[model samples]
Target chain A: MATAVNFKSEESQAELIQLVSFNLDREEYGVYVLKVREIIRMSNVTRVPNTPYYVEGVINLRGKVIPIISLRKKFSLSEKENDKQTRIIVMDVDGELMGFIVDSVSEVIRVSAGEIQPPPSVVNGGVDQEYLSGVINRADRLLVLLDLERVFSQSERESLINSSL
Target chain B: MAILCEDEELLEGFLAETSELLEKLDDDLVALEKAPEEIELLNGIFRSIHTVKGASSFLGFDLLVKITHKTEDVLNRLRKDELKVTPEIMDVVLEAVDHIKLLVNDIRNGEIVERELDEIINKLIPYISDAFRESAVLHMESAGTSEREKEVPASPVQTELETEAAAPAQERPRIEAAPAPSPQPPKPNSSKTVARGEELSDNTTVRIDVKRLDDLMNQVGEIVLERNRILQMNQDYLARENTANFGEEFSKLAKRIDFVTSELQMQVLKIRMIPVEKVFKKFPRIVRNLSRDLGKEVDLEINGEETELDRSVVDEIGDPLIHLIRNALDHGVEDPEERVAAGKPRTGKVVLSATHEGNNIIISIKDDGKGIDPEKLARKALDKGLVTEDQIAGMSGKEILDLIFLPGFSTKEKATDVSGRGVGMDVVKTNIRKLNGIIEIRSEVGKGSEFILKLPLTLAIIQSLLVDVENEVYSIPLAAVLETLKVDTSSFHVVGGQEVLKLRDSVLPLLRLQKLFGVQGSETSLNQSYVVIIGVAEKRMGLIVSRLLGQQEVAIKSLGKYLADAPGIAGSTILGDGRVALIVDPAGIIEMEESGVTGAWAA
Candidate 1:
């Protein structure tokens, strides 16, 4: 029977978790800090046949082929016309190493865990919420948390594996 | 380092929820294909998309949210009965799902994909009418939809009149008239209702990370090891502690521990269970695309998409299935004119089906078109020097079919866009072999061909028959072992300068484990000789071993980078005694035997 007052008092000093944020188009998104394996500049990617449209191709990382996906195309973002400020974030999901292309990475920011709120029913003029975890409000900007695991299920990941092979 | 403090709990929750939604989306989409008019299914699809859209939007994944929203709009119309579920419409929705899959992948990579949704949106445009768009605003406000019912009433009156007038003339006319007014409302309405019904059903589902499940399996394996130690300790204690009723107590404790450990092991294995529909869903589009590209009329049919398999096995089986489907479409199916000339149906039928056979899952891709011509395969094999004239003469039809899986072998005179790249079937064999599965092809000229793939329920744990070659132990997957026999050395005879063992009536080439693995052993007596009969790619041989141990369930551990490429060793496993025993790759060993390289063990 605890009311909103009880929660407010408990939430007075909110817990903040630092996240490395990046931008795609004009919006900023944050991924779990530990999920990221590395950040590197663009590299040559070999095209794999019969893959989904958003998969840019696969890159050879020390002889191991890792699929590279364009975050812009994946999220249905407007295709970037230029290569300026583009970066690839490499991450390991379910024991597979995959790379994601982003516009540019911003600074790591610490926002109170309590400050993060469940995604609203609608956002950015009615954008969908399949890829989002939650939204964290910073001083003047908002960081959208991403659910990486949901981003690729076992089947989708298998497609990447098949194309790579 | 401060960034490391970011709470993963919330993110994990999102992952779990979204993944569950995606899985539901996948299941409903597959079901939708079977029962296209099921309003409840349409509703289920609508909710899945809506939920995904809502979640992505909240997470600030504008790209994901936006695309899902567009797809949701199309589904919303479907659920409302404004849009009809035509194959074309299903194609668009499936493609949208593929796009969503790509978006999810992109999100996982921590990238924002911004692309024009116009292509997908354009695909949805023709389905929507001005009236539907006018009512879309009202539908949005109601959320639950008096607006849907409004469109339905108006359309139903006109549709009923059209149906009454057109029903006497032709079935196509009524279907065409019903869908023509506005395709938008039915799509969303169907999905929405279906989703609501599914939500109301008392089916409980839990989301799990596959990696975590794999870790749990590994931990259970360690516990089994610890249990073995405990059992041994208990036996020793029982002998030392000469108290009465010791036997009863020790036996009960051992049985209980065994039961608990086995249950725990089974529970962990179940966590990795995934339906075969995950692999089945992509085939419809593939079949459609291939049929169009090949200029052949094919009716691609699928059955038993609900079959469950381990995640790892499912991951490995997709490529082989694709190759089989491609091969069937390209080589098995004849052209329309040829079919008509043969007095058969002009439209070829390719049926992909899965069913459980005993403990194994059998997936068969059958085609009702031109079957494999054994003579043609034999001629090609001879032309390619894959087999000699004598070999071809002695070969059976099944043997000829097996020749197609040989690397760089293609019987097609002219390479087409669909196939004949000479890379697919061999890859199918290799991949299937990697999963410890077997592929068999059956065909007759002028009839159809069927490629059957027999796969284990899971790849993580395998029942292996432990055998001793000299002093070292090796595991042979029970799936590959046909029979074990104790051969008398006197029954061996030399044929073509190779030792062969006569079992029953057939002569099997004898490959001695000691000589094969370079183990120094003294000559053994005839009565003591053991032979393990194994089959690979339709080639059967007898593996002569020093001793035969009983079968046991073994958890596979990859040999990692240092030893992965090592010949003869498929992977390693820890026995109950905690000793690492290498699992033998029967296919690799068979390849070695076929290539006239019998000295693999000597190396």
Candidate 2:
């Protein structure tokens, strides 16, 4: 997922997609670097009662209260206790600032858009196909670019809740 | 290029000044109709028009200058006792004022105003004497020649025509070329204009861009957060102190920081305070025009124009207030003949007023017209198939009265231009709800109906008392919270599977935080739990939480569009301890409290 951004002259001519890669469970996922406002170490996230299971709760980033969702829980991966490596990536998704908890934020990398391709029909980690945008090869390993917008889309949540009701 | 830049700046100032003057002129002109002998108000109307004319002529807005001059002639005649104030003449003056307003608006868009001015001028010229008319013609001729045109004065909030007339014309314009000309041609009648113009200003104030004030407010908010972080760090220091003296010094400094930040927040909020008169000023013109058009004689009285609200609230609330006023006139007030037949006064009375009650501002529009008959409303609802006959039968008079707010509910069979298609009241409700406000209607048959719009003082930041519900923290706006106390669970009566507590004489319905938010947790029996008693207008309810946290000032942040309509959650705010807490919606809670007003409904 690459959001539009103004870049330096060198990068201007290049079809580069900058992403912040993070480790969730055993998989490495990348989201548009422009979407990430900041990355903070996992801190006290007050549990918000009566929210979806994946919404770990909210945390205070400066004076702004932003909702935090666990990426592992969101993807339905097995839940694990927070470790020293855990980081909360604060992002602005369509103007709403939110935080996503991941095992660790690896590095920010710029990859060519031409290298990235659409995902296969079924993928690893038991993640829903609708949340997957594409997969790309970085070095020798495969880097999964997550569609954060679709992952946290409201329509999907409502439909899920509607079916349960 | 410099001239172009200067012109843009001058035009911006001109628009702001003219609009403000026109708003006040509207009130004064409407008031003149009621008390034709109030010479101060007549002069007030005259001076405002004169001020507009002077500024427009200086700006080379020849069309606006010409129009206001003619309007000024009519007003001057009325001021000179050369003409009498009649309904027809008052209408002519108001119509001229209306055209002037249109011209100012047109000039604001950088377009030359070319309205049908000759017809309006012909109507106004009858009120002007020959000598005054000839002097006006001479002034217009000289206005075109640069040699005769004086150097335009530096922008003043209210410029007088006499000062413009007195300026020394310079062939070449220079920055700060001349000091303001002394008030000129001091005629005795001119003194009256002076007397009227300066009466409205007792305290000197500067007009500031609202955006700049908002930026300052936001910076102050950031300072508060920084202070909180400092306090938190100081607390950490106090917790593990190696040297007591050092800890004491740090604590004192932190406390000082806290005090200064609190004072600064107050100062910032005070600057954002705007008088409610900005909104109220436009209503008299609306009422006058509306009553005249509807063939109903209405006496619209406005009071408490001095009450202040937050700048943002003042900007938003005008249209909703206008809609309610229109509804009051169209439906609530009846025709003069109908009033006479009903043994009421021939002229209907509508009182629009504003007054602060505690932290909230209560603006009520009350009309002494044909009061809303609940029976007729019920019949209308039935005809519209909005409610079943049995449901209508079971409803109380207040409940039936509320049906007017329901969508697709219009009292008038024929749609009028004022409030068309019955969509206004529902939209009014939604708009007030957006501002965290409430609109309540009270009516008596054959009497008038009163629409009370209760609103918060400020929407951006509010002092909230944060509380813990299980593991989650939620904030209750301090303005809505009446008191917090522990109540025995045994005192709760489970009526029809819904829980309510009897607090002294009143039976208070209780909404348990866990149940309201649908928290997935098991219930535990306790002797007592902390309950925050909250009030929205006249309704009160108890919110049961696990613990009561201390109060803090919260800068409201929107939860975005997807969650905007979420029930019970107004917004989210960050706490001093670096944790996010949801700000509960008291209005929405009250709505839930009212709708599920019945025991089973609550369940």
Give each model a TM-score.
0.62, 0.76
Candidate 2 lDDT tens digits, B376-403: 9999999999999998987778778888
Q: lDDT tens digits, residues B1-603, model 1?
A: 011214344333334345446645655675686688788778767756766665554455555654676577677677777777776877787777767766665554344456455577567555666664545444445533342244334333233432343223222222322222321111111111112211211112334555555667776776777678567767778687645666776677678677667777777777767678778876776787688788888888889988877887887888889988998988889899999999999999999999988557899999988899888888888888978999887766677788999899987898887778888888888888777677888887889999999888988788888998777678888888889988678888888767898878567887876666555468566566888998764567888888998898888766442234444557767666545667788887777777776743333
Question: What would the TM-score be for candidate 1 when compared with the true structure?
Answer: 0.62
DockQ per model, Cα: 0.02, 0.38
What i-RMS does every model get? 14.8, 3.8
Name model 1 segments beyond 4 Å from true. Answer: A1-165, B1-44, B74-94, B116-248, B503-507, B525-528, B599-603
Instruction: Look at candidate 2 and give me any clashing residue pairs.
Output: none
Q: After superposition, how far is residue A107 of candidate 1 from its true place, in Å?
A: 47
Candidate 1, residue A84: Cα displacement in angstroms equals 65
